[model samples]
Target: MNKPEDAPRAFQQAWNGHDMQALGDLFHADATFVNRFGRQVRGVSAIIEMHAPIHSTIYSDSTLENELISVTPIGDDAAVLHSWSRLACGPAHPAGPHVIDTLFQAVLTRRDGAWKIIALANVTLADPRTGRAMLRV
Candidate 1:
């Protein structure tokens, strides 16, 4: 059985690599992805598609640092993870690295003996002057 900690680390690794498929695999089939842009995409296919552009873009370096705030088990099949992430943008986004930071929350579920994310929500925290996110690290 995989611990809840494993899922978050896997998510970070997959995201940094820009591996759309791998990242999608971390989600449940009916997963919901709420981007920082306020756009919500449901299902693994949509999630995969949403990240494809990112992977194709050159100079794109995305890093996610998550501080697990809390974890609650929902019955026996699911868990809710409240976390804050400091997201740093890469060169491809025009803002460059360390220019932006985003906070995120996620809900994960165990399905067929694997832990998958079921829902996610994120928002940007940026510098008012430059309109760029300020990274903590």
Candidate 2:
């Protein structure tokens, strides 16, 4: 049993490692995820399904560098996390090789003595050159 502050750090480690199973396990059964692309995926199972292919194909060799901005506890069972991450897509990516940074916010809940992500939302930081969104999540 880790402290509440470790939850987001653990998630970032799992994500950077491209461990889908571990990542999925960090979400509550009824968790929901939203991306900057306006896509919403609900439930832990659905979240797993949504990320399976992504983990296998696109992010097979990707690396994520995260900077946790804040973690605010909302009662004893829940917390909100604000973060920024730099994503470096590997050669396996279909969109070609590139690196981008994105800002994200997530709501996490402690259920059954474990910290799980309940809701997540993200948006790209924007590109300075073209003034366009760089990352989708």
Candidate 3:
């Protein structure tokens, strides 16, 4: 499989499964993650911690759908990628099972023959009605 596409697909699977450990495993030890909330988490351990609460609460039943926009190879070992995505949130969300459009980006590097995400960022699209980010600030 193509590593560039495979990596994020695995991430999406882990997220849909609510498996924080597997999600954290996809990131490098010193990886950085920025969420739609604008908070940043550094390091895999911290990243896991950052996701635990969300996975057990608001985003508990969320699933991801991402379409790869581009994958730019930086060398045999690294690449940057972007995707158009949506988070389908279930009953736990106030709106209930609505999908939120998002833009995703990541930088991945090969370590020990496996691609690991070094940086990840998710941006929420603006609400068509209000012209402001769909996510609460």
* Candidate achieving the largest TM-score: 3
- Model 3 misplacement above 4 A: 127-130, 133-137
TM-score of 3: 0.88
Model 3, 1-137: lDDT tens digits are 24877776887888999999999998999999999878998999999999988899989988997778899999999999998777899999777778788888999999888888999999899977987756433
Give the poorly placed runs of model 1, Cα more than 4 Å off: 126-137
What TM-scores do the predictions have?
Answer: 0.82, 0.85, 0.88
Q: How far off is residue 3 in model 3, in Å?
A: 1.4
Specify the highest-lDDT model's number.
3
* Cα RMSD, model 1: 2.8
Residue 103 of model 1 has an lDDT of: 70
User: Distance from true position, residue 111, model 2, in Å?
Assistant: 1.9
- Cα lDDT of model 1 by residue, 5-57, tens digit: 56667777787887888888888889899988899999999998888886677
lDDT for 90 (candidate 1)? 73
Which portions of model 2 miss their true places by more than 4 Å?
127-131, 134-137
